[model samples]
Target chain A: MTPTSLNHGASAARPPAAGTFRFAAHTARIPALAGVGFKHTHLDAILADPDPVGFVEVHAENYMGDGGFPHRALERVRQDFPLSLHGVCMSIGGPQPLSEDHLARFKALVDRYEPALVSEHLAWSTHDEVFMNDLLPLPYTEETLNHVCSHIDRMQDVIGRQMLLENPSTYVVFENSTLNETDFIREIVRRTGCGLLLDVNNVFVSATNHGFSPMSYLMDYPMEHVGEIHLAGHAVQEDDEGEPLLIDSHDAPVADSVWDLYSIVIRQSGPIPTLVEWDSDLPDWPILRAEAAAADRILDEAAHSFLMGKSHAVGA
Target chain B: MTKATKTAFSGAVLAGAVAAAISGAQLVTATDAAAANVKCYGVAMAGQNDCAAGPGTTCQGTSTVDYQGNAWKYVEEGSCASMELPGERMGSLEPLERDMPS
Candidate 1:
């Protein structure tokens, strides 16, 4: 949906615990299992059946508006399922300073919903006060790192919650870039004390586009810093020169290779809150649920192994 | 090549590219048409099948084909495009590669 669709629905709610900003202390935690992106198309099915999944995540910008079906339905879903606020428009990595207006809107939503987790991307989508509504890549330089940290700190202050930063899926890289994507992400988390939302599809897409192994990038990433995981679909387009360009289009099923990488990530990170992001070609609720179930299986396996490790340690 | 030859060659190249893309798209469309009969749902698009402006709707029908060169095709009910949503195509990658918005 256009960023404009975010307009005209639901005023932000003050979190139940007023005056205190430490939302994580009381907020229902995102269960370390499979959750699906909440789509308007599936609202009816969700309201009717409320099928069993770990939790549900919604694009924070989508519900920024005031009093519409989105708010009504999302409120109902919130009653039964834990929710995470995922933002697509914060422009945290843009050259210009972060938008206070958007930040205020986000803060209001967080206060109202008290989502289990909150996240924005490490990419920018705005420049010169114009909102492009696309997640543009950032140059991984020392200067950019400082700029992004200031913005993230400001965001955490305004929202009064620990934020999670997701890596952007890139098609091209800057020539003068000094740091790799993993290093950049680690530095951001280190500096801001924010958590990470490691999108496996993004790692695979960026690694493939930039001529690297997805495994190496995952190994290099600070796995302990990750608070959540994202698995989505991508598309490959051939340009005018007949070369394949990978695009992070969340419109299909998670690719097999990405799924494998996700399993590996789970083996390392234990079980983080995982989301199946199908933003465009959203399938029926059952299809999306099936995708979530696949993720659930991975999470269940990982949790079992984790428990086994703990028990063995106790015995020793 | 001279400017005239360059222009002519570019024209031929554009024609070839368009033809190839259309043929490839048509093949995909044909596959969807074949799959349509077995699909259990129907997806409807507004203009282009971009999630931003055209997140589409769930409706019952055989896949609708926009023969007027609009980029949306019904892959399945409750499903629109398999690849990138149309609006996403105009994002950063286009400007970075060609200095023009797609």
Candidate 2:
């Protein structure tokens, strides 16, 4: 059903202590369990259901407003769940300087909530202060890499915590791209000491969009630096050349092929806190939670494999 | 009715808003006041908004352009139609502009 067709959590009450409320004293970490992206549509369902989601994530821009319903909802949700603030507008990859105002607002939010994990895309979302609002790709040049690492360093310093950089699902390859996407990310991790949020669906989508192997991309990914994982649905449509193009549209269920790739990665990475993101055509809360539960099963299997390996090592 | 199917009958748009009764009338009033205060920020060309523009803006970062008469940005109480906004996306009591003001 459509979001407008569902119950509006509009009637929910603000906590009496909301106005004077301060962020809890400690920072919350990313729980190594399944999570779903926080959507206004699903907030009440989340509070109503005790489904085993480890944490919740939100677009940093969504809650950047001064004060209102969005802020109240997020604060209440924060009281119940650990949060991961995934930013889309820091424009870390752009040649333009980072926005100090945006950083200060972000820092204020992070300070207030003390989120366990803060993340942003390796792509740029703004140009000359006009936000395209889409996560546009970056060229993988050495100069670009150094520039991005510095941006990450600055963001980490301002936020008072290390942030995770996500690999973007690209449609067009830059002619100036000099580094492989994986190594490009590896260098950023090395130079900035930031972590990676591996989006496997992006791996598959970019692989299909370009002529590369998703598996190989995953193999070369710096799994050592991964702190979180994102699995989302994408729209597969043909480009002008009749080649398949997969848009990172988080409006559908996890496809079988992407799930297969996730199965492989969870086994190797031994269960990073995976998230299911359904942003556009959001399904009911149960459907989203079931997807999280499915990820939990994969994590469980990964845990089982790791234990078996440990048993074998002990036996040897 | 099952929560998923029950949504068809109740027309609940979001869960957080769905659970408002428990927070008591203070919250319901607060939410209503917040809803009443949503100002249509006209400068939000394309999808430069958090949410509540119109179709194609079901989520953040989805608006392409040309906001309709139904879009809005949340604002503090009694301040709509007065606050200065950027570009042509001027402030209004309603979220939508009915036409591209810029």
Candidate 3:
């Protein structure tokens, strides 16, 4: 499934031992139910009385430094929760060759904290030498497919485990794209043996902004490749043509439509680890716990239904 | 493992252990106090200083320096309030209301 006949040169070398490296089974001690992204504001609460969520996720880029409070806090939570390193700045889908420095930093973090799952965005963040510090969109072209796959392969090889790629919340589309975002992502995963971090809110936002049906996108998405799910809130703006464009803003609660879509996704994919990402304008810890509880109820219902189906089969 | 290798790996494990202990300490602790002396600034493109409060926004007055090592100008509500005041260092910064770009 190599894209464009290009193969990442394989070496027999093992990755440098950075931190406490552990496999998924050891890393994710808890089952992949509902989790929340960790924030600095909630660290004390999380430390005092850990949330009842199944696990927690954090941005790997935030912990790339030597020694700090972020690392200390994460280490505390790691004892009781399965951690997934959801990185925001890897820029795997960028046009330029991957930066070895950034890759080294990622490796160091992975080695230090053996996350249950490691993930990055399916978009670029830098062009030439300018770091835009945003997950810019990528065209679904063959060249990009190859570029992203190579980056993922390099990451997997360096980290000694499979990585997850999250779909981008795009504001603009490239005219030269030959494939839709979903198909391109599927191809990347199929080629690199990576997983997908499906941000359902991003799908709804991008579909609304681009005049597409989010329902259809969900229908066609590869369910098995999804290792985790993200639910967040968005803000919508109308263009001069009076068309609404939704921005993936994590300052609010999950939209009703998104929650409905999430329930449907849970029915389809079973209960995977879901996260409520509130990066900006974070509210009190109680508000976030309530959000996690909502996701927990969905997962609980799904699990109950699953068991009921199994019992029915046994009786039959 | 080589001596150096063992040493580095030991250090990392020790760090991981310390991080773990701190995680335990943080559970019963209060939020750290904010830094007192640190200042925040935003350097935007020159001459487009309509940086005032918009709908659902607030603006503050501050001073900014342009490229080419020029003097600082007092910016009020995203507009230049005072003339370019020259000094060896950038003048005292007045807090400007920055509209959160949604």
Candidate 4:
């Protein structure tokens, strides 16, 4: 069956509060095309020419403050392209209860921008009311799974929408983890009724760091529920054991291997909304735009092959 | 200190506070124009600076250290001198040696 048709928890697991909040009547959905992470520095260039990409994404925390240049620029960008609000510090996987204040601000953004897609990392970053300022890994035990699901449920209820959760790149693994990463994620989706955001670069980084196969991880991933994809660059370093360690640094262009993996996923999944993220040490707008354009080319090819396959099957 | 005298004195204090607030607003307006392109220190909240987060940390949101006086954000050029922060710290034109959250 096609990945789109293999619904894991698409409609059945929505929280009752999902219907409480009303989105704008004209809220647009992100198309099955390539997008780029929206950088404030590229606002002028994007406004000057906004055609190269299908959508733009922003870190939700960056725009959480009261009215300022960030919000103003986002408003301008939202007028032109579909937006994705990617939250970095929700700490959904943390053992603590979700922060009501952070959730309220997140809900406010969802209400204000009405983004086409909303996502957060699977990793936790806060403990004891102190945010660690990084996406820290969590053990994949039954207890942790339950905690993550409850957090996801609360987040969905507060925002009144299903959120996509992105996989993380880890530097270390816990000996107490009862379940593997993919199985853990599958359980979270089964319980929380949320979607998955397949970050191919993250998959590559984690696979390399943990000595797992990226292809094998993708094969086991719950791709049917994937609503979005992320591609970013990583910094390479040596671990304490003198092994290669990859950091999800997002400071450079999409590496060639990541592009290859992204192509494979798109060819199979048939064109999810993919984002090219270059968060630090960013390049010129045209250079970033070129990266998105490259993803678009692959997506276009996948679309053609899918259409042709359907026509041939009908003929048969 | 009779009741009538005290009432008059309190009204004068209120008037002075109001006058000071009005002048402060005017100053802010005038300084706003000249504040462009100035690196103001000891103002950014935790994880909100444009970039840089001391040692052992990389890019944005990596700074768990809140309000590092060394981390400066671009604010209005002339306004940094007037901005007051918690702990009696003032925004500085250059990186500060004080108010580094421990």
**Candidate of highest TM-score:** 4
Residues A227-248, candidate 1: write the lDDT tens digits.
7889988887754567765678
CAPRI-style docking class of model 2 based on DockQ: incorrect
Q: Candidate 2's residue-wise lDDT over A47-153, tens digit each? A: 88966478998887777877867788889899989888888789999988899999999999998877777888898878897887678888899898888988998
lDDT of 4 by residue, A136-199 (tens): 8999999999999999999998998778899988889999998999889877876777777889
The residue ranges of model 2 lying beyond 4 angstroms of the native Cα positions read A1-27, A311-316, B1-102
True contacts kept of each: 0.00, 0.03, 0.00, 0.03
Question: What ordering of candidates by lDDT runs from best to worst?
Answer: 4, 2, 1, 3
TM-score of each: 0.69, 0.71, 0.70, 0.74
Q: Lowest summed-lDDT stretch of 10 residues in model 1 chain B?
A: B55-64
* Candidate 1 lDDT score at position A157: 87
Colliding residue pairs in candidate 3: A19-A111, A19-A112, A47-B27, A48-B27, B49-B78, B51-B78, B52-B77, B60-B96, B60-B97
lDDT of the structure predicted as candidate 1: 0.73
What are the chain A TM-scores of the candidates, in order?
Answer: 0.88, 0.88, 0.88, 0.91
lDDT of model 3 at position A34: 78
Q: Which candidate's lDDT is highest?
A: 4
Give the DockQ (2 decimals) of all models: 0.02, 0.05, 0.03, 0.08
* Predicted candidate 3 versus true structure: per-residue lDDT over A70-144, tens digit per residue: 577778888877788887877798877788888888888778877777889998777877876667788899999
Give the alpha-carbon lDDT of every model: 0.73, 0.74, 0.70, 0.78
TM-score of chain B of 1: 0.22
Residue range B1-102, candidate 1, lDDT tens digits: 534745555887989988876765575555465344324444444233223532222111112234477677766665333344446744433323223322
Interface RMSD of each: 11.6, 6.5, 14.2, 6.7
